[model samples]
Target: MAAGCQGCRTAQHQFAIAMAFQPIVDVETGLPFAYEALVRGEDGEGAADVIARVTPENRYAFDQQCRVAAIEGAVAAGILDTSARLSINFLPNAVYSPVACIQLTLQTSKATGLPVDRLIFEFTENEQMADTSHVKNIVDSYRKMGFGTAIDDFGAGHAGLGLLAAFQTDYIKLDMELIRGLDTSMPRRMIVEGVLRIAKSLDITVIAEGIETLGEYDVLRGMGVRYMQGYLLARPGFKTLPPIALPGELYAAVA
Candidate 1:
């Protein structure tokens, strides 16, 4: 473990944090591919409510604890019996040493009887990471350990093609900003087309999240984007894995 992270490992969180799961579905197959664990509060508060309390001092501990909590919560909710993987969002900046930071997660996975391959670690571009090398190390280390890595919010923030060039991740979730008006916006479609081409060339899977309308879903489905997540499909269930619903036509096709 890095010396800088020692203090954070022992730090305690002031507020309670809970886990909510949102399903990521394979649109073509009309089946859930994974469930992304979202942070929530004990009193039914949103993620922003809990995020507002994370300071630099408590970030590492918070990050570490979130992993354990997500896995434990998923197991308690019977995720182990499902074929879908458990996707957990992580903070690259909070990880001092990827190898060291993952020990607890590994332990939790083993205790819950969830194989390491069943976990997918996702990180967004929202975090302002100072050291790109550290992030690369974390990604590479996790990949080496046989866990899936994903870049969340692909087009919404700091990391994009630049980060993709540095590290080839297993998945990239297209940001909702790009998907917001995709059904009507030619520019957005053009951009997504370009991104899709690049992802295909890189052998990375593209998941369009935050889908809420049939139009958006139709457009993406027509474009051959197989994976999707959003309220239109299923909202995040509190401490549970929600069932997925697909359109009748598409459901029949996939079925």
Candidate 2:
């Protein structure tokens, strides 16, 4: 077997934290929307770099810190509110630390007066979750506390379906790769349709990610996608997002 990669635990522990906010728009209405907090290492390094340098023992703590920083920064900047949701990413392992992180996040929310319902915890499909039972328990706990949960990059891998079945996610984000050429590709269209069908059956909201082109947007809208995010909508940056508007025809058709 290949040797296990190590070092990320230490590096992640020492990595500085930064936040990049992306606006989530309602595809039908197109307005200055809720913010999705993106995390980056302030040490001039990416999350992957930090993950590559740390040991597994400390990885969850480091991940929790990054997540807390994102929420704290957003609240401090007055960009987040009780009316608008704040989405923060959480590594699968960090789910086990929900009690601690949730306490901190709740405290931040209390200080900012942002409602617990407006806080969304996002989990990416990139990492394998070792204890899904524990993860589900933690996720349920957060939901009971009025927080929403989402699974990012849905339909990107084998575990995506499992996650959907296991967690009562409030939102399911479609992977950008599956959306890039959706208008022209039957395969991509089929995949998105299938995901939508499942999401609808589960009463979960669907958000199509990486909608950078009109063609992509049009196709997703036709597919009944309700929410969207990407450069075409708004890039991840420090600046506040301007209100977005749908193409006139799109509004007329939906209206």
Candidate 3:
């Protein structure tokens, strides 16, 4: 193993995983909203570096540890309750072992006494589905268990609309790159509009990610985007979120 990998392995086993809460706000109401738990490795190594050292051979282990740590940390900190939904990012490869992931998550919830329905699993756009049948099966199992699944970076990957049509996703998060500069780009606006239309037809909720300015928020709001996440609302940090209210007008207009 490379020095970095060797060092990371030792650190990974002993490292404390900390949870940071990033508020997912209702685009129209502009209020504090759902909290997505961001995981960080706390062993004097940056998270990016730690993730890089995680190989396909050990990806499942790495991700499971992170998930468990995030849940435990959140519950211990009193950030998770019956009313609060906890969103956690899961790599595509992790879904290959979906049963294990689901089991671990459910076990955490049971141990913490938090409802499984309040946990949201967010998968990135780059995850390749080696077996669609297996992916669907895993999704179905989680749904049966009352957990929600979200596809992250919806527009930037190979899956795009096809994945939405194929998988049963509760939420589709638009890529930040797509949301950036959307106010000035008609093409971008049109693409987002198309996504919103598709999502509505499928009954899937859409969330715009990486909004840094009111201009972007206003443009998305006008485009019928109902949920948003970006620096403008709140950055990802360790603080617990305050109460969040979804904008009634935005939902009405979208409806």
Candidate 4:
């Protein structure tokens, strides 16, 4: 076993994990664009509860297991029939060998009948990367394998802009703090707008996460954000795909 992946050996004895899915919508289409798989406990506890148990040695196993469970759970939940892709959050550090570690994910995708093309792997911004080149390698390998990559919780973690500069990804989910009170805060709007401009220039799709109100939705929509997620749309469903309910105004606009 690799040095960092020591945890993989004893991971199964430590804890069991599960997935909760939340929808990401396309306001223009008024349909499900993607479903983000969030890690949770087997009994449906919050992600933090399960993640707190991860040690350096076990993180690799934890990361690998999360991927398998997310796919299996989503398949059991009937996500494959929908056009929405499955977006799974991953720890870049847990990836010891990008190509080798991905074999199980590939096998899981085939076993579940989920297309590799429909899989989107997102890295959490909160996890500080020790070796950025490793992350780049992982991203490159995934892309080559026909999976989409994203940066989750953008603007809320260490070296946000620096990470972007290091590698371009398919998507960036704006941090909830940036979306909160966005309807009322001019400065926040401006900051988001600027980020939007940068993303556009780089051809990276931006999804505004943690949207909670019609006002926030409208502001972001008016600002040209095509994708969104959060309570205003749907909450995370335990091993289930929640229905997306777009605001009436958005529905009308799409119509």
Predicted model with the maximum lDDT: 4
For candidate 1, write residues 180-235 as lDDT tens digits. 98999999999999999999999999999999888899999999999999998889
- Indicate the worst ten consecutive residues by lDDT in candidate 3: 1-10
Of candidates 2 and 1, the better by TM-score:
1
Order the numbered candidates by TM-score, best leading.
1, 4, 2, 3
lDDT tens per residue, model 2, 1-255: 011122222223455667767878876676544778776566435556655755576565566576667777777766653255788887766444555445556665787667777788888775677777877887788788888888888878558788777776888889999999899999999989998998899999998888877789889888888789988777776523334445664446556
lDDT of 3 by residue, 1-255 (tens): 243234333434433556667778865556544678776656434567667677766666677677777677667766654355778887655554455445666676799877777788787767777666766776677777787888888888877777777786888899998999988889999899998888888898998999876668789978777778887666666634434334454345467
Runs off by more than 4 Å, candidate 4:
1-13, 249-255
How many times do residue backbones clash in model 1? Answer: 0
Better of 1 and 2 by lDDT: 1
lDDT of each: 0.87, 0.72, 0.71, 0.89
> What would the TM-score be for candidate 2 when compared with the true structure?
0.83
Q: Poorest 10 consecutive residues of model 4 by lDDT?
A: 4-13
How many residue pairs clash in each candidate at the backbone level?
Answer: 0, 9, 1, 2
lDDT of 1 at 123: 94
Whole-model alpha-carbon lDDT for candidate 2: 0.72
Model 3 residue 13 distance off true place after TM-score fit, in angstroms: 4.5
- Ranking of all predicted structures according to lDDT, beginning with the best and ending with the worst: 4, 1, 2, 3
Residue lDDT tens for model 4, 6-75: 4443345456878999999998887889999999999988988998999886777788889889899999
